[model samples]
Target: MHKKVLNRDRASFFVITLPALLLYSFFYIYSVVLGFYYSMTDWDGLSRKFNFVWLENYGKILKNKAFFNSVTVTFRYAILMVVFTIVIGVLLAVALNSVKRFKTFFKSVFFFPAMISSVAVALIWDQVFIRALPNLAPLFGVANIASPLGNKQLALYAVLFVNLWQSLAMPTVIFIAGMQSIPDELYESAVIDGASMFDQFRFVTLPYLVPTITVNAILTLKGGITSFDYAKALTGGGPARSTMLIGIKIYIDAFGDTPKFSIANTESVLLFLVIALLSIVQLTISSRSGVNKA
Candidate 1:
């Protein structure tokens, strides 16, 4: 009877998961395999014939100045986004957790930006930066209110600012949960011992938050590295192509000017490796640090 029950349970689990497994194989797994295959070929996404050049395309990417520039821009954007989002999210979470008034209202207000569609957000901000800002500049005694997206020096920072604004919701949620999970006894004990709020946060809160921080950091970094929709809709890689992310570069290579499918696939593969590497490193550090204690 026990053996029969175990067999039936295994069969039920497989039945429940089979559809999802099949979909994963058909979509992500298959697409990743195709990307690798094309990256080695000289396929321009057209023509009847092309030869595989193994790693020649990968080597060319190293020598490509535009590719290098895109990488630099992505790093700048991701670093700033991760830093600002984590700081802002943590502050909001802590403040909300400590207060009893209008908590839900503030939470909803912060998270609402994250819920908006990226393209729609881009369009809304484009108007604010390009049209409204210039018009308002005169009233503020400003002579020239140039569009942020049109300035080569400031275009990357503009994208970073907007993206940071949109990406704070998840981290804020995670942080509140992390803070709340600490036993009330710990905080009470610290208070009785005459420890100030800053001391408690430094010694207790931050240590408990390490895992949450790691999770938010890794996810936000990946989002910044592969950002595309906003770049396409807002800057269109303009102002001397200053704000082009790796994902946008991949799109341009595959669809604009010269359509080189293989080159785009190569860029995609590189982006995948970067995200994967960071995830592994973060998980490793998190595990070594232990989730519960400092």
Candidate 2:
């Protein structure tokens, strides 16, 4: 009787999960398969006369200078964002963790940016970069500079600055949580051993925070690579594609005038593979470090 009841429960669980499984398979898995199929076609995104082109789109993308430039810009953006986010996040987390008064208030203040819409943040930064600096230029004895987004040389860095500011909060919170999880006894023991605060952090806090660090690093890396809204709203990958990223390039190819469906799909496939490979590498490094620390 117990065995029958167990089997019934298992059957019910499977039945309950069936709909969600079906939905995921249909929407996500099916789309990926279709996208792969489309990548080999010469579709113009909205036509029925599409036919398979067999690697032409892939060749075109690989040969396109603008596409290669976008890839380089995307790589640079992701690397810098990841480095700064991790460093500043760890610093802010340490500061917040060490603070005794109104810690929650500070955390809320720091995290408020993360809650704001990306478009809103971009618009606000756009105005600041365009107007606020010029208004203060005379006082600083400098000429009014156009918004960085309007300057080809500065646009990408401008976007990077805004992206970093918007992204810092989540990693900050994660690091703080990691630091808080470390037992006070560890620090106390370090102090008794005549260890300085920095030493304590280096030896005790960092080791304890490895798992959280890993999580935040991976999240930030992916977010930086996949960032599109800020690029779209702030610069629109403007100034002769100087600020173009892989995400924006993909968007333009897939949806802009003269849409190239096949090339867009190829770009999407390449992007997925790049991100997946990088993520795997990061996880491997993190896991190895975790084992060494253990």
Candidate 3:
């Protein structure tokens, strides 16, 4: 009877998960396989006849200076995004967790931006950068520095700033939960030992929150690397392609006026490999650190 019950439970679990598994396989796994096949071809995305060019697409990528520039921009954006988001999120989380009044209200306020569509956020900020800031600049006796989004030197950072407004929300919530999970007894014990608040945070809170930070770091890093909507809508990879992220470049290569679907797929494959490698390295390091801490 126990054996029969175990079999029944396993069957039920498979039944519940089968649909989702099938969908994932069809949409993601199948698409990736197809992309690999297409990457070796010279398809213009709309072509009926195409020739397989093997690794030629990737060879072209190596010689493409614009592509390399996009790579540099992407890594720069991702690194900055991950650092700022984690640091700011932790600070905001710590502040909100310590507050006794309207804590829920503040969290909601911060989290609200995450609910808005990235394209909508871009549009809203574009207006602020174009119109509102210029109008208010004179009041502060500051020279009207018009449109950072139009300035090649500042466009990338401007987009990063907009992304942070939305991306900080989830990480902050994660940090808050990590902080709250620490038992009150630990704080009391620290106080008994005459440890200052800073010491308690550095020794107790941070050590305990390592796992949470790892989780947030992976998320922020992935988001930064794959960011496309804000770049597309806010700057259009403009100011002479200064903010042309890898994702955006892949998109334009595939869909822009001179479509090169083969090149785009090759770029996509390279990006996937990079992301996979980074994720593995990060997870390995984080696991080792966790084990050492334990």
The TM-score values for the models, in the order shown, are 0.95, 0.94, 0.96
- In candidate 3, residue 227 scores what lDDT? 91
Model 2's TM-score against the true structure? 0.94
Best by TM-score: 3
Instruction: State candidate 1's TM-score.
Output: 0.95
lDDT of each: 0.87, 0.87, 0.92
Per-residue lDDT tens digits for candidate 3, residues 56-144, read 98999989999899999999999999899888988999999998999889889999999998899999999999988899888989988
lDDT of 2 by residue, 1-294 (tens): 999999999999999999999999999999888888899999989887988888888898889898899888888888888888888899999999888999889989899888998889999998898879779878878887567888888888899899878879988988988887888998899999999989998999888888888898889888888889898889888888877888899899899888987888999888888999999999988887752464
Weakest 10 consecutive residues of candidate 3 by summed lDDT:
285-294
Candidate 1, position 112, lDDT: 94
Per-model C-alpha RMSD: 1.6, 1.7, 1.3
Query: What is the lDDT, from 0 to 100, of the residue 252 in candidate 3?
Result: 95
Superposed model 2: Cα runs more than 4 Å off: 291-294
Clashes of 1: 0
